[model samples]
Target: MSKAEIQTTGFFTEREFTCWRERDYKNFYPCQVSKQEGNYVSLSLGDMSYRFDDTIAEDIARCILDADLVTAGKLYGYIPKPAMRESAFDSWYKMNSSGVWNYFGEGEFSYYRSGGVIIFMERVTDEDDTAEIMGIYTIDDVGIKLVLESSSYSFSKLDAVWLSNALMEALGEEPLDFLKTSTM
Candidate 1:
């Protein structure tokens, strides 16, 4: 949220992702590295949190990173970037100009797990047109598919970035640096 937080939460380091995975799937308490006691590293997720020894902490991190790579892969696929600028622009214009805004033209990227795999779906609707891209990945396979609900429309990359950042934050990471511009 703050500049400091952004600096600390920059793109998923293997360590951060591992930490997130541990917390999300294993229900390991989220914690920040604090101090070290011989072979053990102390961690505190929050006030009144339990401290873990180094061995347990390492085990938790390993479990988190070891979780099926499907979810992580899907997450990576949703990072909207320069390549998607044109599509994003087109979608924004259509949504704004079309009278569909009165009835629909809403955009959303919903994430959930099904059958032990993670699914990330982007649904956008405008009047008679709709575009949906869904990313489904599991430990064994990964795929990104387009499902046309009606006519056709483009998904907004900006929306994708927003959704991606939201997911990262939800996983205890910092917001993305996609839009940040250096003043110098």
Candidate 2:
């Protein structure tokens, strides 16, 4: 009935509590992060959390045993910068009246998967129509294709779920209920 409330802990009470974030305000959804005993950092989206180890490799772990531990932007690729989105409507809305056209148009995104299966999305709106649009594609040996549903993949169900959750968060879509997937 109401907006969902985010949970926090004494470990996350400070403004310094958030995970890696994009500098722009409208850039990305701010998923929460957690760490304990300096072992790993978990970037969580709803019930799905991706664990990234914070410790160095065992081969070099002993080299910094006595040094003061610090968080020197240690979380980068593990928590990437949110994908940026832009639209022609944004430019026109900016160039036109600000009062009545404040929220006049909807996004028209172009979603495509790269050769490596990495997804990329871009806004290509051309009108002020309040029509929302998006596309979903499956990447396979045949390359990108519009499929009804994506079920099978070369990766595990757990990785699939994590990627789904991350993309949803990045695109500002609702997080699906398939949160707990087995690592099998």
Note the Cα lDDT for every prediction shown.
0.28, 0.26
Q: Model 2, 58-137: lDDT tens per residue?
A: 10111111010111112121211222233222211111242211101222443343342322133444454332342222
- lDDT by residue for model 1 over 36-148, one digit each (tens)? 22443322222322223333333223222222222233446431222222121122111124221111112233334445323333333444433333221112122111121
Model 1 poorest ten-residue lDDT run: 136-145
Ten residues in sequence with the least summed lDDT for candidate 2: 64-73
Task: Identify the candidate with maximal TM-score.
Answer: 1
Candidate 1 regions with alpha-carbon error over 4 angstroms:
1-31, 76-184
Question: How well does candidate 1 match the true structure in TM-score terms?
Answer: 0.24
The RMSD (Cα, Å) of candidate 2 is 20.5
